[model samples]
Target: MSDPKSLGLLAQFETPADIMHAAMAVRDAGFSKWDVFTPFPIHGMDDAMALPSSKVGFFTFVGGVTGFFSGMGMIWFMNKFDYPLVVGGKPLFTPLFAFPVSYELTILLSAFGTLFGLALLNRLPKLNNPLFSSERFKRATNDKFFVYVETADPKFSAVETRALLATLGASAVEEIHDTEA
Candidate 1:
């Protein structure tokens, strides 16, 4: 078997601008497995990273449509076939009467879709990450910015990646290894 492989190399930056520039360079260098961490959301980072648009809206739309149709079907089955009811000679299945319940189900299922879609898409509930092992990385949530390029990338080379990060003005560069590896 081969030796354990590295997870990636992490470079710390003093400011958002520094991290942003590093991300662009990494992207342009044809590195697909890289990420940037910031204390808070940074505007234009999406464009710099070349990330794709989220598909959560598609999930919500599907959920809403399913809810509306199911609501209509349920009302029709109950009133028209299961047990026909005549109150003051009203129609068995009236769209006017069904509107309220249909609207409610549409909102409810759409919400469920949005919640579950986000969780699944983001791979949520991840209790741990290797990056958390670094004491310096803890500052990422407070004030520091970071850019990391994984060794799994096609263009990754430990020495060359470190050199590139240094050239981009990284304050500190550190290699991260996978504990399980």
Candidate 2:
């Protein structure tokens, strides 16, 4: 059997301000693998955590560009090459005529990109997590805020990290163990 592994420590705070302070402190302490959970979005948390802007917008842009070109190519191939047709001296293909379909497709593919990109980036479809085993963590959806420092971090030390969290005004700190380990 595998030896028990530490998932790191979970620190609970009573207010948003406390959690924000803890997050900033954790970030300043050079800990990389850490995260904070709150009942709702907290302003300035992203800056405190020093997280970079999301790349999902880039994915959406690429998808939209692909859709636009694909739509134009399909319209051109169908009308100008596959089965040419002339109606009232109109051109076989024109941007004016294809704009509607191309616009619709661009929007469609961009929406798909946003959805799938978010899912992939966030690692969604996860039905379970070790944190769910903690009854106190359940309050994350209601009132409490939590900051978790993962043992995977290079600078993580159970004793020092927990002490740092306590000094940052965490109401309670608990160690999270890896069930698979």
Q: How accurate locally, in lDDT, is each candidate? A: 0.89, 0.91
Estimate the overall C-alpha local distance difference test score of candidate 1.
Answer: 0.89
For candidate 1, give the lDDT of residue 166: 96
**What global local distance difference test value does model 2 have?**
0.91
For candidate 2, lDDT tens digit of each residue in 1-181? 1266778899999999999989999999999999999999999999999999888998799889988988898999999989999989999999889889999999999989888899999899787888987889999999999999999999998789999999999999988877666
Which candidate achieves the best TM-score against the true structure? 2
Model 2 steric clash pairs: none
Query: Model 1: which residue pairs collide?
Result: none
lDDT of 2 at 82: 100
